[model samples]
Target: MMSITFSGWEAVKDRKNLSANEEPKKGHCYMMYHGTHLQNAKTIISRGFQPSKDGLLGPGVYVSRNIEKAKCYPLTVDKKDKVVFKLQVRVGKVKKINCDNHPMQKTWHQNGFDCAWVPPNSSISSIRSGREEDCVWDPSRISIVDVACCVDPATRKELRRLIQHNNRSGGECDLCHEESDCNPHPVQSCWQCGKTICAFQQKHHCKH
Candidate 1:
C-alpha cells in the first residue's frame, strides 16, 4: 500500500497516529479531506460518499490531501456553515493528470487507475487555489474518519452540538447500519463573483 502523510500542524495536533512524511505507493491508505455544508456532512456521516456522475475528472468523489484546500469547499457556503470530513482513502492505482485536457483526464479510471490526481500549482486554469486535489473513482475506497464542524453550535439554531468522534483509528460509515442512497454533485465558488457553480457547469459560471 502507498501511504503519504501530510502532517501539517492540524494533523499533529489532532491525529497523533499520522506520521510526518512518507512516499506515495499504490494501494496505500491516505488521509484526505472533503468539505461540505453542515447538513451534507451529517448526511455523509449517515451514509457513504456517492461518486459524482461527472466532474473535472468525471464520475468520482472529489477530495483533497490538504485540509486547508478542503476547508475552502462547497464554496458558496459561509465558512461558519461549512464542515470538513476527514477521510482515510485507500487509493489504489493512481494517475496524475496535471493539466487540463490531458488525454486521460476523464478516462483514468477506465484505464485501470483507481484515482486521478491534480498536483498543486499545476497548469489547471480552473483551479483558482492551486491546491492538490484527487478524484477517487470508487466510493467504497473512501471512509470517513471524523467530521470537523466549523460552525459554532452556540450561534446556529440547527447545529445544537458538533459531530464528535472519539476514535480516529477505526473508520466506519453509518451506511453499514442502514440502507440509503444519494447522488450528490460537487460545487465550487466562482473566483470572481463568489457564485456557487456546479463542477459540470463551471465554464458558464461568472460570465459577466
Candidate 2:
C-alpha cells in the first residue's frame, strides 16, 4: 500500500515511509502541482491544484453561478517530466449537482475549490493517479459529494445564500401567479443578466 497527501504546498506521493523524491522505488502516483503553489509557507491555502487551464483560476471568483466552464492545465509524469495535458471536462450527467443548498465544508480553503482526484473509498494514505477516470472535478464535473450526499449545516447555509443571490431559488411557481416578477417563469437563472425566471421563459436561458 502506498500513500498520497498534500504537505509543504505540494501533493506528495509517498510510499513505505519514503518520500517520492527520496524513495528507491517510484510509486504509481505523480506530483500534480509541481509549481502551481508556493511551498515556502508552512501555512498555505489550496486553490485546488488544477492544471491551470480549467478557466476558474482567476483571482477573487466566488459566485457559484459564475463557474461556467472547466479550465484545463497540463499534467506531467514523474519519470521524464513529460509535458502533456488532461482536459477535465464536466460530466454532463452530474455537472449540475447543485451545491446551491449545501453548506461549504472546512476542507475547502477557497471559494471555488480545486479538483483533487482520488479513487473512491481508497485512502490517500498510499494512492496513485492511476488514470483520468480515477479522479474528478467538483460541481462543474463530478462534485465531491459523490462520496457522501450529506453536508454540514454551514456549507448548506453558504450554498443557499449563493443560489438566492443568483435568482435560482428553485422556489415557488411565480409564473402561475397574478404578478410574475419572474419573466422566464420558474427555476430559471441567467449568469449573464444574473436573473431568475420561470418555465414560461425558457428562452431566457439564452438571452441575458
Q: Which candidate ranks first by lDDT, i.e. highest?
A: 1
Q: For model 2, what is the alpha-carbon lDDT of residue 163?
A: 31
lDDT of 1 by residue, 44-120 (tens): 65566877899899899999888888898887889877878777787888898889899999999889999988888
lDDT for 63 in candidate 1 is 90
lDDT of 1 at 114: 90
User: Any idea how many clashes model 2 has?
Assistant: 21
Relative to the true structure, how large is the alpha-carbon lDDT of every model? Answer: 0.67, 0.25
How far residue 36's Cα lies from its native spot in candidate 2, in Å, is 17
Candidate 2, superposed: residue stretches over 4 Å from native: 1-89, 92-125, 128-155, 167-208
lDDT of 2 by residue, 1-208 (tens): 3432211121232223322223112112222211111121111111222322232222211211101111111223232221111111222111111122223222222434442222222333222432111222332331111101112445434433443333333323554332222122234344455455443432333442
TM-score for predicted model 2 compared with the true structure: 0.18
Per-model TM against the reference = 0.64, 0.18
Which 10 residues in a row give candidate 1 its minimum summed lDDT? 5-14
